[model samples]
Target: MSNSARVESPLEHADFAGLAALKINGGVILREAKLLGHLNLRGNANDPDFLKGVKSALDLDLPLAPCSSAQNANTTIMWLSPDEWLVIVDGVTEAAIEGKLRQSLRGHFAVSDISGAQTMLEISGKDCLQLLQKSIGYDLHLDSFPINKVIGTALAKSSAHIRRTGEYNFQLIIRRSFADYIWLWLQQSSKEYGLSVTL
Candidate 1:
């Protein structure tokens, strides 16, 4: 099978061409990021066999509550909507991992490769939450926004699935075409913090 069959991402756009909403060095700039293949998994948590199967295969606990996560060395599982989860794997492991999951699952369940559905933007800094609140509607205060929480909310006049990757770092998951728009928004918001575009 071609590389596209097992895993793929929409970052194939012309270099630094899709980012228009950003200004770096007084011009549009691009910051390259590392993304493993993205996967959307749907299943009910009430099923022990199904849950146990996932744990056995991934070595990561299934997050049973909303806005929660379970992590292993290289994988982080985030709750995405009810009865659904998002799995992130380093490098290219979508295809083989998808198959392994299919074999491990039974009963009502569905999994789809969404590596192409969204591109990742890693926006992080000491003042990342300040910038995040400027871009998103969710309350970014530490009292409200704790670590390891996932939220699908509007960001910078666009919709994105945002996840907190660290205390001051976050991963914004947005559609392919909006890459430039969101990237632009980040720089614009970060300007107050003396923005520095690295790659």
Candidate 2:
């Protein structure tokens, strides 16, 4: 592929940029973190060398605790399982980051560039929790689901890896094939509180 080739997000047809221009104030705000790189990493969590290599490659410690996440200015790493993680970074940086991991790490480690397989959506505003409540069965209480926590669960009959970023903010990593369905679900579910789209 040429450098000049156009890159399109899974929700490219949704035209979120156009909707963002309307500037409608709603209780729920949504934004697509379009074309960000998604990488699925698998390795031994018990191995100190693996952890050290990951930290060296990404500049952030791998979140080893269950349903936890770690983030810095450049990347966010979510623990998917005892031995699996999902790393999100700027779209242009995945290749370089993956290369660093491959070069620095050794022994039974795997890194797959799954960027094209998923997309991320940021949901916030006062009614964001309510919107989420209508979709997922997971307890949304902060006490139960603290900030910087990640959970893979069913959302509106589909599935997503949901991460709480703040009191009223969440980041969802969803499958590309389900993007349109989730988009429509959000539209209908947030109709009562109103929905605002941001670029």
Candidate 3:
């Protein structure tokens, strides 16, 4: 393997860095959480050992309830299903974390690195709620979708795992193949409120 080989983010061609310089008072802010590690974890939710192994490895408890998520300083665990979770961690740590999980866990478990298959985009600012309301059918009201809740839903023509990170902020986990399309859709949708980019 050559050291010169570089890993490019899925939205590399969108030139987010260039847009970051623009001084726009946009109601919606878009920031790509680029190059983060995405690990799909599966195990028996009923097994105490499985739960203990995960806690030992990540130092964070799994979110067992449907559409729930838990996060610490280094990792965010989202409950994807009864027996599966999506774990997001800092960039370049997927292999090490996976290794820890493999070492700690025993019997009937699976962990796969899916970092390259997708990307995360954070949408926030004043108009973020309105933007999301137009994009997905899910209710954005705090009563319905409170903070730290994750749901897999349709976003425009594509799909994403939408997570509420704050009162007016959301993180969208979108597929790499639809990065360009979603970027374009965001630009158009936020035209009235304005759109600003951050590196």
Candidate 4:
């Protein structure tokens, strides 16, 4: 009976249903709880050579400087620290992407694959800013945290990779282990406005 059994996971489409409880407490929210293929790129943001390599690899310029982001349709490059950034994408195309970056940027830079290490939680709606104000310290003003800004900021008792996905849609990319706590915090925060959680 135990010859070579290949078992598939029962959890097919991420945490879509469990988010209902959180959703019921606030405005509509969508959680793209996928193992978002993520990579951390670190180097001199002003280095013209590095930028050239990055442009060649991803077909887009790297988001140099703090609180910046550059995107193509699928890949989003976000600035983390002054010298670090996070590259995010969907689907099962991680190895190819990582390999390309590694091959392209052959210098004093780091390319780390963090796919299994983090999870993405998208919190959007009319109450997105209000909900975020309760958590982070950085000014979430329209002029400050403008559209397409990617910030590595705080989220309640945890850290998150946050980005403005739309006018009202903000995405929170967090670590895997801290998810449960973040989920609880989100539920508590969105209680004032009726939340509709979807995955």
Alpha-carbon local distance difference test for all models: 0.73, 0.96, 0.95, 0.77
Q: What's the TM-score of each model vs. the native?
A: 0.82, 0.97, 0.97, 0.85
lDDT of each residue in 69-157, candidate 2, tens digit only:
99999899999999999999999999999999999899999999999999999999999999999999999999999999999999999
Clashing pairs in 4: 23-195, 23-197, 25-195, 26-193, 26-194, 26-195, 27-194, 27-195
lDDT of 1: 0.73
Of the pair 2 and 4, which is ahead by TM-score?
Answer: 2
Total clashing pairs for each candidate: 4, 0, 0, 8
The alpha-carbon lDDT assigned to residue 42 of candidate 3 equals: 100
The whole-model C-alpha lDDT of candidate 4 against the native structure comes to 0.77
Q: Which parts of model 3 have CA positions greater than 4 angstroms off?
A: 1-3
TM-score of 4: 0.85
* C-alpha positional error of residue 152 in candidate 3 after TM-score superposition, expressed in Å: 0.6
